[model samples]
Target: MEQSDRAYQRALREQLARNELTFAHAPIGQAIVELDGTWRQVNGALLQMLEYDEVELLAMTFQDITHPEDLDLDLGLLQQTLAGEITSYQMEKRYFTRTGRTVWALLSVALVRGLDDEPLYFISQILDITSHKKQVQALQDFTAMLAHDLRTPASVIAGFAQLLSTGPYDDEVTSIARRIERASTTIVDLLENALTTESIDSGRLTARPTALDVRDAVGTAVQAALSAAEMNEQELEVDTSGLVPAVAWVDPVHLEQVMTNLIGNARKYGGPHVRVTTQVHDRRVEILVEDDGPGVPPRFVPQLFERYSRAQEARTGSQRGSGLGLYIVRDLLTANNGTIDYEKAALGGAGFRVSLPAA
Candidate 1:
């Protein structure tokens, strides 16, 4: 051969070697299959992914190794690509290995054509996504267990605290007992709210709805909140104007908890004069709790209902209640098919509105 021809041949050999290296070391599993789905060519990753040798894989069709449940959809997409209806397709599919274990893969398939534009083979690129799927499933199970465990302890703490407060005790030690009770109550609230938020996020909460008298529920909540309001030297007002004793189909305990939280929050955060009003509409009933204290900080309103969130800037002093009140309120309302929102109060303070479906 001439000197120039020798150089050209050397360069061609180097180019071919580079191409071979690229195919062997590619990160994704790559394979070329004939129209009948027989493996014509496969890279190193492909062979390792299927746990098969080159000769073994070449003797089998793609359908032979695909998961039985996923084969139909995979074949449908392949047929579409072959029929010229689509150029390529991608899907999360599964394949079975020789050891009978399933492997999850994200498969991308493209049609390869010859110089004459006639389809020659199908090219597939696959990525193992089994690890990612396992992580997601584990996270879901953890959330469910966390929610279940937290609620029982919370109920016990709150129940015992209530028992201690109402149980017989000396007048001198009553204050200390009350403080202990308060601290325990706060912890209980935090746990309950956190668990409820997790339950809502995981779609595990269920509501047993029934007809309830809105006025009676609100009255009971107001009575419960009055003690807190009086402790803060705050005035509690109830405005049931145009609101009759209407019945609503809701979870009574959940709705009562919602009312209690909203009222208690208003008393804790509002100015000296706190007003709770109720209005009945055609389709829904709206309860508004307004306070005269400095309103919630503009920035904190958006995340007020988030778990463990506190409106520190909006709080009056170091005497802050559990930051979980609004979060619990939101969760309870959601469970009862209701909604809550915070806005500037018409009475120059913070306003919280709870809307419940009418019976």
Candidate 2:
């Protein structure tokens, strides 16, 4: 019995040593916190991440370094984990460093329990995401600059060109103004998409769904895109005989944005003829936009709606795009509790179907 006990003690000590070595050398921040939020142990990575020495961190609780606005959510989730409601929790949270700089981390935490199944302490792993967060902020700032610097000049140029096209200008001059108008309008639309992307990505835009006539939204989008279609010599048509006029429960602004993107996409990439139609399916409203151009290549269909995704044709074609339109459409539809799908059209081109809840 004495030999057996000695062997067991040696095995346990080896296990503990291995655990200590792993904890000390982890690449990311790792910490053990007491049940009452006091820092019981911390690794060197955590010390560097927080710009705090080991002694200072051990003397402080997580609450002391967490941002005030994020503290409540963190505490709530921690309480839930402690009460056996959750096994673990993960969140992107802000932490204030010892030097007073705010940093972002993807924090994952799990409770460590004793042999009797009682809570002993919390183990947390924090992966710093501060660099990624800064990159996203920079992109948003650039988009804002585009909206402010380019949109105003483009709109003014388009307005003057429109007047010259319809006013008492010579035919030759009128034709030049019409070309300028088309170019400027395209610029304005692209800028609008950039601004919308920034708003959506930053969570500043929200969908307010309501029961409204789908026809009005479709009409507005069709009218807004008609000029562009005409400039490309594409025919645009709409058919809504099968739709119930007041059944769609969607945000009106978002619905229009969706339609505009679809119609514009068909005009820019699809064949020379485009059609918009509506129907009812499974108590939902489906708006279908199709064109007679060559369909999307099969290989690119899977990522067609992803942000900044462009087909080879689009990249090499004369009509260049920012690759933001389809991504924005999908996001706006999702916000309104709607969905969009793509298929090969019977018209020998690309097809898009947007579905929304019925009121």
Candidate 3:
């Protein structure tokens, strides 16, 4: 009877080992880790994700690929699972892939116990969710831009409607009508340009190139903006001193649109007048649009690029904007193989620098 029992125990041990290995080599990312955090068995999917071989992985611990910020939380949850305080846990964490990319994942882990009910190993299942996160961000950006774009003309129309009661006078009524027309024109232009976009949730804009002089486009946009600047009692300056008048292969209309938004934002949010400067560097042409108003708060800088996200400054007065201006400018710039960045203007305000590839 004792010999038969011994044989049964040996068979059970062999079966368990086979099952662990079978799980390790499965199609999805799975791993068996010791309670001490050392990886005991890693499946093929996990190995490919981390870009490590079976032999090399067994020598490392889970702490290795975990993002520094997420490490402590992971450890705490792991401790709870091992102590039987929790049966299992799931979390979103980042892992540094072998190629130096931060891989985002949804990780589920459970405690594996021995026959004596003592902690033995941990089982983990990881689902890659990086692409999902990006799509979510894009959708959020699209929604914000739409609100900003659609609201601008509506607000202008409302303002004009209020002024109509003060004007049975011919000139006054005509001026109001013209302003209303311009506001409606703005709305029509935006719709015409953007309404045909591919699904914002499923895709993004791409660039199309044509031969055009970006410098000439800047001059035209500046001329258009000068009227608004004058009305604001501000001086609009144009500096093409550094510009090389050459045609570039890009969508000239898009560049004009980018300038329109930037210059308009300057008039709305900046101090009197704005400066538009152009220059060429290496393979790219650059435009700098600056205003003398108070620059964005340091804390708000990161959020400034987010669509429809207004600054606290905008909340204080009529200086406020739809916040879609810069975001739309950025998206358009991206579609044209260009880039935009913010800086503190030497003139004691905010500055936006735009760069586009040269022909």
| Top candidate by TM-score | 2
Error of 2 at 213 (Å): 0.9
**lDDT tens per residue, model 3, 23-104:** 8667768988888889988888888888888888899998988999999999999988877899999998999987888888
Q: After TM-score superposition, what is the CA distance of residue 74 in candidate 1 from its true location, in Å?
A: 13
> lDDT for each of the candidates?
0.78, 0.87, 0.75
Q: List ranges where model 3 is wrong by over 4 Å.
A: 1-169, 178-204, 230-242
Please tell me which model should have the higher TM-score, number 1 or number 3. Answer: 1
Candidate 2 lDDT tens digits, 1-359: 99999999999999999999899999999999999999999998889999999999999999999999999999999999999999899999999999999999999999998999899999999999999999989988987986969999999999999888777988899888888888898899889888889888788889889897788887788777677766555566544354445478998888888888888788778857777777876888888888887878899999899989889999998776888999999999999888999999877799998889987
> Which pairs clash in model 2?
271-293
Q: Global CA lDDT of candidate 1, please?
A: 0.78
Per-residue lDDT tens digits of candidate 1, residues 1-359? 69999999999999999987887799989888898899888998888878999999999999999998899999999999988999999998999877778889999999997898788999888898989978876886786577577667766765665566666877646555566656655665555566666666667777888878787777877786775554334576655453466677788777777877776776666656667777778778787888787888898878888766787764557555657667778877877888998889998988998888988
The lDDT of model 3 is 0.75
Rank list by lDDT = 2, 1, 3
Candidate 2, superposed: residue stretches over 4 Å from native: 1-28, 34-37, 44-56, 68-90, 97-101, 108-123, 127-135, 235-244, 281-283
